[model samples]
Target: MRRRNQVRQSVAVSAALLAALFVLPLLVVAPFRTALFGRETPVDETEGQPFVSGQLDGESALRVLDGETVLEMDLGEYLLGVVRAEMPASFHPEALKAQAVAARTYTLYKLQTGGNHGDAADICTNPTCCQAYIGEERARANWGENAGAYEKKIEEAVAGTDGQVILYGGVPILAVFHSSSAGLTRAAGEVW
Candidate 1:
């Protein structure tokens, strides 16, 4: 009986040590992880309040995924690229304005929500995953003769609607746009 009790106590101690080995690392790293890749917080009840500072400014940078590389660029510059890539510059100015608002809102929403890219980026260039973006050089190549004019137009759209985002229940809406939904809206359950 004495030998059995010793074995059982040793087993319990070993089990506890093994559990600590696994759990201690998690406890130590969790705070750092949260700090590195932001924590999600409930939206404030305040409505139409200006969002803190995820906007296009001298200090702001957006992480963009181009192929396997991630580049950080000025937020305003990034918005110009997104608008040009996502919308036809030939579209009406109001349409461009609406798209700009959506893009800004979407980016801000991602920043607030801890992002979907495994917490690596605030937004991405993949239209399927996040938003579509084209660098200035590519936009020029794609536009040819219209490059300068189209770039200016898109810039204006972004500037005109700067920091504006549509909110539902005090949170930025998903702000997703599709060219055509085959004459039917996608069921929410289907996409999410």
Candidate 2:
């Protein structure tokens, strides 16, 4: 009788220890979920999945405002769209290359400085605000027969200068450009 009681007690102790091994961790960790994992930002699931473009390639993504909608795309692909919208495809390749670098720099600068489009967007399509962005369909419609060639040119310019950005004081600089400036560029303080 004494031996049977000892065995039963041993079994009870083992079972309690096993249960604590699983339950205790969950109990201790549940309260810290918000602190450790970040608060969930509300998403507009009604809008469906956001549009994605280009090769993706595991690069960091940017959230852009496409008119009323928010679009997410890879950095290089975003630059391609910017270069297409901001510069003429008929321009010399070197000119396009310069524009690509400037656009990329400007984008990086905005990202680092915290974008103005609230937390929902990193940039917008307004030329007056962030930068102009030409969607693939609009660009195709505008270019007509030359759409294929023009798109390829822009892709080359972006790919050739991958990861390049303008820096001032070892940080990315806001490199801005305009359409057909009549005079040499003026300081921001002088103009704005």
Query: Any residue pairs clashing in model 2, and if so which?
Result: none
Q: What is the lDDT of residue 56 in candidate 1?
A: 41
Q: Residue 65, candidate 1: how far off, in angstroms?
A: 2.1
Span of 10 residues, lowest total lDDT, candidate 1: 44-53
Q: Which sections of candidate 1 miss by over 4 Å?
A: 1-59, 187-191
Best by lDDT: 2
C-alpha RMSD of candidate 1 = 19.3
The sequence of per-residue lDDT tens digits that candidate 2 reaches over residues 60-125 is 588989889988878887888899999998888888889988998899889889978889899988
Query: What are the RMSDs of all candidates, in order?
Result: 19.3, 19.8
TM-score of each: 0.64, 0.68
